[model samples]
Structure formats: structure tokens, C-alpha cells
Target: TAKASAPEGEDRGLSIVEVAKARMRDSVVENRGQPQTTRVTNDEEEDDAEDEDSGQDHGPLNEAELSRMAAMLSASALVVASAGGRRLRKLHVDLNRILDGKGNSGVFLQYVLSRLHGIERKSNTRLNPEADLSVLEPYEEALNLALIVAEWHDIVPQLQEQQDPYVLVSYLFNLAAEIGHANRVLRVKDMVSNVAEARWFLFWAAKRVLEQGLELLGLQSVEHM
Candidate 1:
């Protein structure tokens, strides 16, 4: 186990494991008492978006914003985990590639969020968190989409065991590409009828999975990238 020296001026000794356990306990308690906000109403969503946009205006970084940016940068560095192996190899660290908004992380977030916004805007209502995906049974593409969800579940344990962020990141990037293709083929936006509920739930599932994977990588899911 890792170890750490006690803080200066402390009378008692402490280890890193103890410090970590204490922090985890504190976090659990703090979060346990907070109510979860799962659904956002239309008005509330617009207000929240406006607030976020206002915060994004040109300005000096506040402590919290700086901290989040630090976290994002730190998180992005984990992409190096993708290059792990026994063989000696030189891996170029390309800031441009890593930070590309059109690349893996950015594309995944943008496509999923855009589809979500489209659904809410066209439907004139927020999605039910408990929305039924079973309605997606008939369509072959939906089955393929469901397979993605199942694939995510299967891969998660392997990711945890292997500690390979590349596998997860690549999975998300490819999933985003596949969904983009499926969306074009379905013409979800141009349908003569209202947006299909089943497809909405499918996209919702996709978004949730992507967000979960992103969170695992210590990444932020931005409203606008």
C-alpha cells in the first residue's frame, strides 16, 4: 500500500490509505444526504443553460473553474494509458489531438448531447428517466444499438481489470460514429411523424452509458464543447 508522511505540526502519524478512507467516508456522507436531480424541466433547463453560458464568457478563472479545468487536463492525460505494453515504443503526446473537440471525447459528447437537445426540443417535454426502451424491439438498428449497451456492460469489467482507458475511449468514439450513421439512415429528424419514443430512449441509454464511461475517466461532460 502507498504511504504518506503526516501533515506538518501533526502529533500523530497517518498513512495515505487512512487519509483516503477518511476522504471516502466524508464524501459518502456528504453525498448521501443530497437529493438527486434526475429530471430537468424545460424552463429549468433553459435557465441552467443560460447560467452555464454566462459562466463561459471571457473572464479570469475562478478557483472552482480552475480546479475543474485542472481535473479535465489531468483526466485527458490518461489517454496515455492506451499505449501500455511490454514492448518499447515512443508515443507522441499531441496536445492538438488530445484537445481536439472533433476527436474521440469531443465527438462523443457533442453527438449525444445534440441528439438529446433535439429530442427535448422536438418533443416539447423532458425525457422520463424511466422511459421504456422495450419499444425499440422491432427495428434491426435498435437491436444493434441495444447490443452496444450490452457490449458496454460486458466491457466495463474488463476495463476495470485491465485499466485501459483506450479501450473505453475507442469504444465510445466508434459507438458515436455508428450512431451517427444510424441516425442519417433513420432520418430521425425528417420523419413525417413526431420523433419516435423508442429511438429517443435508445439514444438516452447511449448518452447515459457514454456519460458513465466519461465519468470513470475523470472527464467532464460539457453542455457545449
Candidate 2:
């Protein structure tokens, strides 16, 4: 079901959720490519015995607790998304680079989310979507993020057509990167009165979009690194 072929004039295909579930189990999943919804299995998607490739050593996976709940969902999603149509011979990769805040990986995005969480916590001011957003200036980064969030309405059909999560993953990564740039210019928690509230609303709005996208990818954003 990984690579679905639709009929002419049709956009049917296996969904990213189906791909994730199938890939995780290394098993067959329902294919959405056909009108009847047939079952298809791609053996290539199944993981083989674990072994580090000679050229790349992932080193030891961290002793940090591992579970589906704590499974670095954001990072994993990014990795999967980055893979696109290709399959990695091994799932292992350098965690250090993936988790680096200076990199454009999912971990870096999570770090930004943690920062937003800290700001909200320290400010002790609740951010509401309904907050006065008029005070927010048209910062390029913020506006860019707004445009991305607005595209959420268009994402479902694209996902349905492409049946690939790289689209979603790419969006999340870009949004996170933009928020990082916006944070450099906007100080939300540090300001007082309407400025602070307006800024928090902006951050909160971005946070909302990020969380929604992550949820669609079967991933999450954390409060702390």
C-alpha cells in the first residue's frame, strides 16, 4: 500500500496513517487507491534484522525511557517524512544531529515548542485564540506562518492524493523554522499589557497549528526537551 496507483482522473491512494501503521507492523494494510479498497502488502517496507551499516554508526540508542508515548514522535515523523518514497536500510541514525536544536530537525522544532511553553508558564498570562490580534504587526515570519496554517484547509486533499506524509512533515518543519525566526524578533512573555497579550496570541496560534499538524502525523510536541 505504500505506493498506490490510482485510475485515470482519480486521486485515490493509501493514506499516511495507513502507511504509518503498515510500516510499523511491517504488515499489509488497507489500500485506498481503488474504489473497492483492496489489501496490499509491500515487503520492502518491512524492517529487516537490526544491524548498523558499516558506513553509518548510529551508536547506542539512549537509555532514556522509550515507549510509544515517549517515542520521539516528532523526530520519528520527520525522519519518516524525510524518507519520502525511499526506504532506509536501517532505521538507526545519529540521534545527536536529529535532536540538535540548531538543526532543522523535528527535535529543534520541539525545542521551540518547549520555549513557548516556558514563556506561557513564566508569564502566568493565559493566551486565548480570541485575544486581540490586531496589535500584532505584519512580521514576515509570522505572516509566513499564518499562510502555512491557512493551508491546513488544503492539506487533506493533498494528503489523500499523494498518500505521502512528506508533505505534512515538510509543512511542520517549515512552520517550526519560521516560528524560530519569529521568536527572535517578537518578545511575548517579556512584554506587558496588550503587546504581551497580542504576542502570546500569535505564539498560541502557531502552537495550535503545530499541535494539529503533529496530531495528523501521529506525532506530538513536548513541553520540555
Best by TM-score: 2
Model 1 lDDT, full chain set: 0.49
Give the clashing residue pairs of candidate 1, or none.
none
Cα error, candidate 1, residue 218 (Å): 0.4
Quote each prediction's TM-score. 0.53, 0.59
lDDT of 2: 0.53
lDDT of each: 0.49, 0.53
Candidate 1 stretches greater than 4 Å from native: 1-89, 103-118, 125-140, 187-195
Residues 81-192 of candidate 2 have per-residue lDDT tens digits of 3543333333333333443335656555566666676566555567665666666656776677667767867876897788767677677777777777777777765477
Each model's total of backbone clashes: 0, 0
Candidate 1 shows a clash count of: 0
Cα shift from native, residue 65, model 1 (Å): 8.9
Q: Which pairs in model 2 have colliding backbones?
A: none
